[model samples]
Target chain A: MDGIDKTDRKAINFSEKLERISDLWQPRVIAEMNDYQFKLVRIEGDFVWHDHPETDETFIVLEGVLRIDFRDGAVQIGPGEMFVVPKGVEHKPFAENEVRLLLIEPRGVLNTGHAGGNRTAQNDRWV
Target chain B: MDGIDKTDRKAINFSEKLERISDLWQPRVIAEMNDYQFKLVRIEGDFVWHDHPETDETFIVLEGVLRIDFRDGAVQIGPGEMFVVPKGVEHKPFAENEVRLLLIEPRGVLNTGHAGGNRTAQNDRWV
Candidate 1:
């Protein structure tokens, strides 16, 4: 078998990857496309208001509800739904129950953005 | 209500968007982040063997089964699974049944890459 390795060519399963994470709000990188990374995260409760001044953030909900509050309004995303929070807009993500999410953004972007605090998770963490 | 318009801040539901597309293999842009675009497409047959020399391509399966065949191997992606086809790697996607997918790539990339023909879809079509 001189071709692409079978084990290395498997698809990244979201549910399987999410099961490897126990901590909330910590995003674990699963795949990358060019300079962007696709991360899987689980969260409940409120997140700090922050803005990725350099890039837009995408949130695709896999399970439960995710509400992202902007300064003027909010968007509630459920399973099979997604939203793109534009760059430089301050937003806060809140979940009443556990929510599984797939976040897509540039590689170096932090979880807390510029709001950096105790809630900030380490960057480049892969599952 | 001078805030973010409620009507304009709704989430993009994958199932709802897929319902609007009756054609197969035509990816319609649903959202954008920076220079990249997120597209939704329904496919049920074989696609042309092609390669994106400028960037990688991401395929996130929302429904049904999708198998991407590389020159030497293949990756089977099902619902909740994803695979990124690296730049310059020739591949063909096939599906036994209808498959709904979320494709992420740079804005100008075509569905058929450089292997353009009748199968090539119109670029920048939004849903």
Candidate 2:
């Protein structure tokens, strides 16, 4: 009883966990590895331009298309693809359609990063 | 040119990277975030029983099925599913068919972990 429970040992399914999220842009924690957290988020439209000065952020597309626009260029990520945004680099994410994403970064990382505002979601919200 | 190059900023496609791997059990690094790395691997049959004493390992299944057997039980991961094998927890991975996986772990961690053997692949082999 002190060790991992049977439920905790089960695999984390993206589609199953995603069904619990009803809001857009708000990320829900699905799993963790060391100090990092794997978050599932549904996003559409455009996101604020920001940068994590302390750590890099990873974006893995599970469904739809996601385009991250940088100062100089942009990268489009579809399902089955991923992109890593380096620390201190400013970028904005845009999706014309609803996109399901798996974001990986250190715990306590803000969705808005340094560009804090109303767009900043409550951190550590697990589904 | 001191910053990220155009080619480096492109999205990393899992399927495209996986096509280059012709061997089983050998993982090829596709991208890196901070000190961590994202690797794509094709695995079948069984793997060595091992444990990483220093860090946890993440397995995201892209195709086929993957079963990680723990001391108490086992967890099966399929496409769009993931499991984090905690550090120092001995486990063995078994696949009935070819399983394409995306592995996330700190740089320098081997496929066999502390259980060094013929299954130990050359570290840092990038696709």
Candidate 3:
């Protein structure tokens, strides 16, 4: 369904959305373009190692730092930067402090990918 | 074709990429996740009324303000904000000053969409 109505279709402020939630690692679906979903999540500490076999996941850091540990190495992402985990490559994202970032992925794709755990958030939860 | 090597897959700074180009309306591909591409563009003045019939377009404002005029109404998107123009709907994006933003769309979609003009930029150009 096209949700471009007057109420929520206005300029979605990032800080405003981030302030609305205190839970970490739970992605809040903010907007959708085509079949892809734009999600915002505040995550800290370690995450489950997983891989999405069908789609790549994009991460755009808005605040703090994020360290994505790959199978062989790790990449540290800073604020105002981004990184993408390719399809089928297992990765675990970690952050020392609270980090806010935006995730872009196809609709219905699980956050933990093939690794189902307590950290696996419900898909399509909006803030 | 996975470009997640140690070189370009690192964190991409938006301000650095926006500084690399002075041309308006041209989108520079910074990173790719699956079939979608993350592009940075700077735009000012007015753009042609266009619509991507095959896919929707996403615009994330990094600096300045963006006004998107739709068929029925218009939207003003500011820095740290975003707006998604639905598919098959006509829209014209304008800004009084240069606006820096990120655009996520499929790899081959043109900027001008069906309303091709001199403002049509070369796709897949990286900064």
Candidate 4:
């Protein structure tokens, strides 16, 4: 409980957490384990094509659908499902409707990877 | 997708995954993110008080309820809730009914921690 707040000791409703945020693309830290942080983000439409060069990125769908496009092809992930994009792979994430998901990655890793642009978000911003 | 398999690209239904295993206390790897592994396990009743000395352990309730008893008190986590037990903190987990959840930690971290007893589980056994 060293890094945890009193709110964490209570049940964290995924649906409720999603309802708390309306912004898209920015990830808010919800929990941390070891050097990794669990973040919640709402995404819709198309995001910039990029890749995390230093670490793998995990995407776990809490609601709606997620599609990750690679050079070769694309994969659609649904609720209760998860996908891990390996390091250094150029890929883009897109969602038709609003999607809520949890991303697990090392601290300091950018959401947009090295392709910093307008969509790049500030890291470690908790909700 | 270097560290991923073809099956990983597909949506992984948590309930369907739970239906595949019937064992208690034994965790089965479901997904991997970098050096961490997402494991699922069914637990009920009381478990030995233990602690992980090197890294924090995460408990995300996929179904049912989880109660983690700490030295000071206990916290009951319901479905969709999560708790992080910091390294070196002694604690015990209990459930009145069967509980299904995800345990995210570094690969090779023992479920039983330093208190290796009969409850100690085999690691990296995928479901």
Taking all chains together, each candidate's TM-score versus the true structure is 0.96, 0.97, 0.94, 0.93
Full-model lDDT for every candidate: 0.93, 0.94, 0.88, 0.86
Q: Kindly indicate the candidate among 2 and 3 with the higher lDDT.
A: 2
Off by over 4 Å in 4: A1-8, B1-8
Model 4: DockQ against the native? 0.55
Regions of candidate 2 where Cα sits further than 4 Å from its true position? A1-3
Worst 10 residues of 1 chain A by lDDT: A1-10
lDDT of 1 by residue, B1-127 (tens): 1234567799999999999999999999999999999999999989999989899899999999999999888899999999998888899999989999999999999999999999999999999
- Please rank every candidate by DockQ, starting with the best: 2, 3, 1, 4
lDDT at residue A22 of model 3 (Cα atoms): 88
lDDT of 2 by residue, B20-127 (tens): 999999999999999999999999999989999899999999999999998889999999999999888888999999999999999999999989989999999999
Clashes of each: 0, 0, 0, 0
Weakest 10 consecutive residues of candidate 3 chain A by summed lDDT: A1-10
Alpha carbon deviation, residue A18, candidate 2 (Å): 0.7
- TM-score-based ranking, best first? 2, 1, 3, 4
User: Native contacts retained by model 2, as a fraction?
Assistant: 0.66
The 10-residue segment of model 4 chain A with minimum total lDDT is A1-10
Residue B126 alpha-carbon offset, candidate 4, angstroms: 1.1
